[model samples]
Target chain A: MAATRALIRRGARDLRLLAVPQCGIQADMLIGAGCVRGIEAAAVTMGELGGAPRFNAAVKAGAIEIRDSTCPAIHTALQASEKGVPFMPLRGILGTDILAHRPDWKVQDNPFAESGDPIVLLPAIRPDIALFHAPRADRAGNVWIGRRRELVTMAHAAARTLVTVEEIVEDDLLADEATAAGTLPGLYVSGVAEAPMGALPLALTEHYGADTDHLGEYARLARSAEGFAEYLQRHVLAQDVAA
Target chain B: MPVTRTELLIATIARLLEGCGHVAVGASSPIPGAGAFLARALGGDEMRVSVLGSRRHNFFTDGGRELFDCAAQGRMDAFFLGGGQIDGEGNINLVGVGDYPTLDVRWPGSFGSAYLYFLVPRVILFREEHSPRVLVPTVDFVSAPGVSEEGVWRRGGPHALLTGRCLFAFDRAARRFRLESAHPGESAESVAEATGFGYDAADPVPETAAPDRRMLDLIRGRVRDEIAETYPAFAAEVLGTAA
Candidate 1:
């Protein structure tokens, strides 16, 4: 179908994608679709994003981009874009050249009124769209970040927001009297897609089960250069053929 | 009482981590993980603590649960987080900006700050720097909501800040930051002098505890080794090894 072709083509464009480590299913889909390279994500608990297979392959094949800061790293990138700043400085990675290698990121001098040494500055980040999986949402677009609000920072830093939720509630359910504060109001969000089990490999809190084996498989595939390239060819660029 | 920077950072984290039941730590978070382990060793009743990261087995104990999920679900009591740049309000940045129109500033990646910041009841922030670069009056971008000026998060907001030269805590009632403690070996005057912003100096401040043998051993031996082995950056700092 022409529509399908265009959709695939659009996704194939090279651009930055801020991905959650647990979202391996999306990673598979993206790789299979040839959307992006392997991955360029932050993983605090690397064990959760499958094993060295996927990680190694992505890195070896140059399919993935790695950073030390993790999700907060991606969020900071978006923050720079949203705030129109250059770079923000951080402390955890200071004695190392992690910042230096990331030439795109500038460690700015402290702009505060007083200081002795030079300070690092992190630039603001603004993503095209921040995608997330939610437990509940209202037709009006009000969404509950649920018990795990992993997507909150992404939402704040993203230029636009898209969410796939398990359930849809009444618009009134999003109110303070009805629901507690910390709920994601409707104004900031756009395009609410009802995607059940969307948080696949990534746990969906109390609702769904994670695809652990699948994550492991992905890890295996991404661990080595040859493996990663083969994986991308079969999973991402190859035509979807009947098994 | 004069205290080392490491000790001051640890003590502040220990107090904020006092009542927590379970905490999930990253491989790289030495200060927080060590402090948590010490709290337990010091006869703190909270037993459900674990050191988890990318390589350790069963790191995904809860099926790819967000790192902050345990705290959010009442399963964890406390945790620690770091940032590339921290604002006066305690929001962090870890990503980069581009070269020209928007130079591409690369972020190491985000681990779990998003979920942790929103859900963890007692989220202690630790950064090794105390100058203006590390601590800004206004964050270039807020990767995580510190106070939720617009009311985004319900549970945590950078409760305590442990830095290279000082220690701080948030006044829950006022929702404003207060000086909770000063690191040993340093005076309020030195800390205030080093920091770019101002805090309520009139508030009472506590002294950080010295690092006991047990605590130091665990930190230098257990926590440090694990982190150094897992990440390339920490090998030298934690393990005293060459890359």
Candidate 2:
């Protein structure tokens, strides 16, 4: 949340964001700050806490473009980008409006099919930067994400991967083959910062669980414009509200 | 003892998972998660259930896209989807109400529905809100169609539509929904009055069976404990027994 505030303070405007598959506070905060010109994500929700108030309000007001998508489509597009492919073919979405709205996405006949099998082809998503929070990072710049492999994909697909970790460990994350399996090598990372409790309202894989009370308060307070402003004033604008 | 409305919904979802070998419940779906667990409990070791958002339930180490990949390969036998608007033709709209980029109402984005709707054979539409507002004659946008055209390479599509008031079985051959049964309080006439879409109905709509004592016992006991891992609030608030 603090990083988002810093970016907003730096005058980031009309930002086009692809929220890997799903997002919560990051998406909402950006929408609330009026920085997002377009958002392409499978879902922008607070999960059990309920709707993302700002994102919903923004969309209803036609403040931004919504490139509505599904989870696999985003992952497949990112996979294409990482693999240095122009596009990748994925199944389903052929008859849906998500595909219809995306003139950029095309339907093509399967080359391997005996007769014909139409498939949806998604363009590669090459983001300018990938930002995430992790539990641990080594001095060698290796970040251990454990089993959350989507971070690795996002890092691999983007031009630069920026990360914040809860702590820096002495042991090289990639020194052991088993640990290396889950570590994002420094080659793909452009920047790293050690911010204790970086992913606060949200949970890190092994570090901590989500601060549900804080999230619940946010969810309750973010429902209205005045309340949202008060929330921003108290959290994002007033102090260093990292969560 | 009389079954609670939520328990009834869970049992209805469980009944839908009768023969499903692998059922994947999406995030924010407490009922379906409970239902999948109920099915697994009754079906013995043959069934595998994966509830998203639970560290203990989902056994995916690959990444966020593992569920999609599993569905694509026909390994996932069942999945649950809901929509802001579900039309007579079985098209679901999670995007929102109103015109394309400029929308009046926006729910969450199409989270994995576009991809999973086609790949998982038994895709159950499980929106609890059954009203004219939700069961529309035509959706504003098709996040994922309940059916797709032939030669579109779809492995599966909508099997049924389950709502708070009724159960609807999709007819892939006919490209429409058939009224299967009505919930306890809802009659055929009441269901029709509440619905905005046109569908064939049985001469005498059967009452949706309530969870029996044994099933309720399981729900109140094991299922409650299991679902708590994913939805603690839901378990504590709704399913918590006053022992």
Query: Candidates' lDDT values, in order?
Result: 0.56, 0.88
Q: Write candidate 1's Cα lDDT for B160-229 as tens digits.
A: 7778766677665655566666666668777777776556654555665566666565555554555453
- Which stretch of 10 consecutive residues in model 2 chain B shows the poorest summed lDDT? B100-109
Query: Per-residue lDDT of A137-210 in model 2, one digit per residue for the tens?
Result: 99988999999999999999999998988889999888899999989999999988888876777777666888
The CAPRI class of candidate 2 is high
Chain A only, candidate 1, TM-score: 0.71
lDDT digits (tens) for residues A120-198 of candidate 1: 3556666677777677888788888743444665676677887778878776545565464546777878867666665
**TM-score of each model, paired residue for residue:** 0.49, 0.96
What is the per-residue lDDT of model 2 for residues B21-135, given as tens digits with 9 covering 90 to 100? Answer: 8999987899999999999888875899998888898889989999999998889999999999999988989878898776777777889988888899999999999999999
Evaluate residue B171 in candidate 1 and report its C-alpha lDDT on the 0 to 100 scale.
66
Q: How good is model 1 by TM-score?
A: 0.49
Q: How far does residue A128 in candidate 2 sit from its true spot (Å)?
A: 0.8
